[model samples]
Target chain A: MQTVSIDVGDDGTLSAVLRGELDFTQAARIVAAMEAAIDDCRPDSVRVDLAEVTFLDSSGIGALVRAMKAADQVNASFVVERPTLVVFDQLNTAGLVDVFGLRRA
Target chain B: MIPETDSGYLQRLAELEARVDQARLSPEILSERAAGLLAGRIGCRIDEAHAHLRLLAGQQNTSVASVAATVIGALEIRRSTSLRQVRHSVEEALRATDQEPDQPVRVSAPDASYSWLDVVQQMLNALPGKHIVVVPVRGDDGRITDYECVAVSPGMRDLSGRTGPQLIGMAISTAYPDIVGGPVWRAWADSLTDGHPRSVEPFTYVHIDNGDASEHLLTVRVRPVGPGLLNSWVMHDEQTRLAERIDQTERLGNLGYGEWDLITDTTVWSDGLYRIYERDPADGPLPRAESEALGLPEDEPLRRQAAEEFGRGETIDLTTRALINGKVKHLRAVIDTVRDAEGRPRKVYGIIQDVTARETSRRKLAEVERQLHEHQQDLAAEHRLAAQLQHIVLPIPETPVDLPGLRAAVRYLPAEQASRIGGDWFHAALAGDGSVVLAVGDVAGHGVQAAATMAQLRHTMAALTMTTTSQPAELLAHLNRLLLALGVSTAPATAVIVRWEPATHACTWSQAGHPPPLHARAGVAVELPRPAGPLLGGLAHAEYGTNSLDLAAGDILLLYTDGLVEHRERTLSEGTAPVADLMSRVTAERRDYPLDVLLAGLQRANPDDDTCLLAVRRTDCGNGHD
Candidate 1:
């Protein structure tokens, strides 16, 4: 599985691109990367670019929920962008699409 | 005047007297001879001839004695007139005698006192060696008035065999009852009156043995000679052979005939019927009720119906199963009624046959059909289980929701085939840093294999999400490489990734051969401008591209797979309009509802896709915090 990548813009906003699948088998790795990106950049808010993530199952949705809770604790704005239909369906089924702010592509 | 016996007259008278002398015959002998002659000529009896002679004499106003005497005179006169003809007839009768006694001779008569019998008998005697004895007789009762002995130079008996009157007055029945009660009697009795003379029909008569254990058969016939009298003859032999032929026909064909008298409740079965039922002839003469007991238990009702229909005067042919000697068999029975002159059933007749083989085969055929039906149902149930397992393994999401900066949502609609659950999926995630990564992809194909592939890809994506925060384009390229590593080179996937920063209001998104997402912001909805790339798992080094969008405060981002925008018969752009309209509503309504409500509302509005929507508002700290 591919690891997560975060690119911080000059304006101090962070965009984290998630790769490969997001499910129970790799949720821990994605979560750890998320924390590291938040710490390294310490940006004002976070945006996750999922436009390249190929697949998502229920465990992937659960991992995203955990990330959302973590962002809330830090008072940092958290958002999701360009989710594949697969990722959105998982969020849709979990009833958390709006919570992650999945951008359309 | 004295009648002169002239010498010429007297000599003529003398010659006439001598002529009378030469013709002189015993009136009794002549009468007997005449009777014999008439009996043969007219096929009547001797006594009947005597009565006829008397009646003819009375009608002529002459003495019976004179009539008798004139019979020979008249015969002589006839002989003289047709000597050649007489000789021819006499010779023919003589030749007939040489031919055989059984060979009959016919003689014609001239209405005279002495009939053709006299001529026939004369002809019989004239053939040198033949003799038929005749005794002179006279009867006062007109039967036999007189008897005397007379000698002719060429004497012969009138018929062959036993002679004389010793066998007279014998009752015919003492010999042949068949002759007494049948046609002979009618012929003989009719001869006693002024009836036409006839010969009795020939029939065999049986003479009982002295011990009464055996009998002899004879063919006897009688003919009326004259009024009230007849001559009869009997021949023996040829009747045993005829009776044997009738018995042979009865045995073949296993044929039996029977009749039941309804009123008397008496049943009669033929010999064949008893044999078929394996019953002794003496045992049966049973009633219809008893005969019914011969059928098996199951066949009793059918037997009863047959009997009832016969009682109702109907002809019924019924088949039923029976058991004989502990083995079941099928029997076809026919019962018919014999009605009296009144249109009511008087007797019933029945016949039976066997048909077990046909019935057995039919039952076996039905059993096979039932088994085949059950086997088909079993196969159908197995298919249903397969479909159910596919659904549980890869489920479709029903609603949309929000994550964070990226306005992302997805839809996973199962395919329409009731037996198939398709492989379409969408994923949305908020990583640990308040950053959101979302993806929607369609695994190649449908059903169980597709679902299993989806599970693998989905877990792989989540794992990578935490490992690195790569750009969306690089993320897809990496996933493609990972798929190739996992031996899924044949399974392709299309996905889009969107990452958003709430504070900067910027969204970076990439597409890997997935449908572009539609963005609704500032009251307008359009598919976001984005770079395109090949689907994952297609090539070893397939690349991807990303584009950035500045998302304003209440922007709604909708992400989905081709299933939402592509139908086989329609263009993808046709499907985009609806998603766009719903996106516009969500963006417009974002300020009035919470993130969850807004997501739910957008999903409800776009129920066609396995829709996933993520709506996030840019929150300001001051007003809400106070």
Candidate 2:
């Protein structure tokens, strides 16, 4: 299982940083927490930071896609940030790079 | 358990114990008795006999008393005049070793005890090489002239190779004409006159016969005693070279060879053998028991096997480990038995070598190679299991599905990687509401985890469809709630559910973040607008709307996942061309293409993803009746 920490910035940019494996085993738990964080904070913009995540499989990628869909439902702009090399490679393979605005910064 | 002793039994036990104590003889007392008997038989002083016995006891690594006891046993057995026959019989009885403490100390023959002539004969026999006693013959004037051959050992061979009794009564002049006035004759006169030992380092002798001559070099030692002279000789060239060569080979190859006489309990170890075992020559070579004890605990099986082979008189080749000087060494040995006429093992000869470095490194390399092979096998097994799971969870019906209310077909293609058995599945059955529920879903991800989630969702929806209503929009909404309840929010899935009523030929369907269902009519294909809904497990309390229409004959509905039409390098519009073109060709040509053919033609077969395709066609009333 992985833990998700959400920070609501002064500029209303809510960030949910995931730590630990984001594979199928931890996907459901991590995604639900991210959804809850978005609903409660209701920030104008959201940043999903995967800097501490050592692994992320396709199920984890699905969770990211789900988070984006849910963010759209709440009228929030979603930006994915600081994905590790492995997660970035998988995301690039799925051709979701520009769609999620994934960047090193 | 032993019973307690009564007073009478205890008294008797003590008396018997005292009798045993009185019967035991102290070392000095036993030595004195043996020495007195030896001195009386050999006619020597008892103190001289004791000193000789003590010296032999030290060399043989035994107590003086035991050596004395053995001497007494030999003398008592020697009542028979034939020395060789008596010695052999005594050795055989000693091999049984019942209550005998001095059996091992009898390895070497003790000097026979007798008078001067007998002592002289014993000394002659004791010399290691060929030797004979020559008594000088003198004229009335007492000048030494010729020598008489009084006694000879079998080892003393003349130029003609005559030995033993043949040369015993012969004169030296008859055997060797040139031997008179020779240097050997001078030595004989000097030894007899002075009664002291004399030696010539290298004496050259020539043999002349039929005009052929050969010279030989021999070192001679002569000692005068009583009325004759004792002599021994050694060759200067051939014998020394042969022995040195054999010694050279043994040391260089780390090889040792030895012989053990079972009857005498006497073992002989070559110098190489002594070096190989790191043994001190002073302590003497190992006896059978000491050598057997050197094996490590794990070598017990090898020892047992070798013993079994030895009993059969078969040669044994054994390799075993031994702890030597705090290091483990591998010892390889080949043993062969030398049996007597009666088929008993009289002696055993063995060749042994140390092969520790080669064997240890080979074992380690084999261990590493075995581990690498097992690791590769483990990976192959895991892949096979994952591939098996894919087939178990997502089973597609053959050709066309013949359900109660509809004729349908389903196809599922998994990712090419054996370990990536993906989750692409479908379910179709007649519901209790008299309508058929048709569904297709693709769970996100691959492998066991994805397959597990897909099975849960399919089973749950099947249960709901069997007992509950068969409505499209309501079913999608319920499934969305089910996903949230199951806590599968991380793995979103796309699905389309259809409810077909056979009574009115009406069909209604809805989607959950899935592509729109395709409707084909009379050679034309059009994508139906998807109902308003989000992907499952993403949004809570998400809404879904459905569109219903009455279907006539010759109409087809196709539902599929994104894998059936999407490619990474192309736009969505362009990727849809294959499906559209295949659909138009199938319907327009009236080619009577099976639903499987249409699906195979449309699917792009991506190696990185899974695909599911389901198709249903409205049948004519007459065809349905058939």
**Top candidate when judged by DockQ against the true structure:** 2
Give the Cα error of residue B195 in candidate 1, in Å. 24
lDDT of 2 by residue, B1-626 (tens): 11124454344334323322123456687788778766544434567678868977896687787777666655555454476754664564455355454332221223221234454555455445788877777889998767888778756777677887788768888766666888887888888888788996787877666567777787789976567888777777657787788788877777788887655557888777787788887878887677777889999998887877766567889999877777787989999875432234546799988787779889999988999899778656766765676667666788787654456888877766666666777877788887888988877876666777788778878888888768878887888787777763446676788888887778888877666777777788787766666666666667777987655576778887767765444544455677877787788876345777777776553556677888887766523411
Error of 1 at A96 (Å): 33
lDDT of 1 by residue, A80-104 (tens): 8887665664444333454566543
Query: Which window of ten consecutive residues has the lowest lDDT sum in model 1 chain B?
Result: B144-153
Candidate 1 error regions (>4 Å): A1-105, B1-417, B432-434, B468-470, B481-491, B501-506, B589-626
lDDT of 1 at A93: 34
DockQ of each: 0.01, 0.12
Worst 10 residues of 2 chain B by lDDT: B105-114
Candidate 2 wrong stretches, greater than 4 Å: A1-60, A63-105, B1-294, B297-395, B399-406, B414-418, B488-491, B502-506, B538-552, B566-574, B591-593, B600-604, B608-610, B622-626
- Candidate 1 per-residue C-alpha lDDT over B1-626 given as tens digits, one digit per residue, 9 for 90 to 100: 11233234344333323222122345566677766655444344456667767876886676565565555434433334366764665676566567655533333322332444454345433333322222224356655322221111143222122232322233344433444445555555555444454554455444445445334443323323322233434333333464344334435544456776655556787776675565788887655556566677776787677656544445778887656566676767676654322233445577755455667788889988988888777545643654565446434344434444332333344444433444455557764455667777766444455556767777677767777664678778887887667652235566788776655656788876566777767568898765756566644566676799876555556676655554323344655777677667665655433445544443222222233233334333311110
True-vs-predicted CA distance for residue B287, candidate 1, Å = 30
Q: How accurate is candidate 2 locally (lDDT)?
A: 0.71
- Interface Cα RMSD in Å, per prediction: 14.5, 8.0
Instruction: Estimate the Cα RMSD of every predicted model relative to the unseen true structure.
Output: 32.2, 18.6
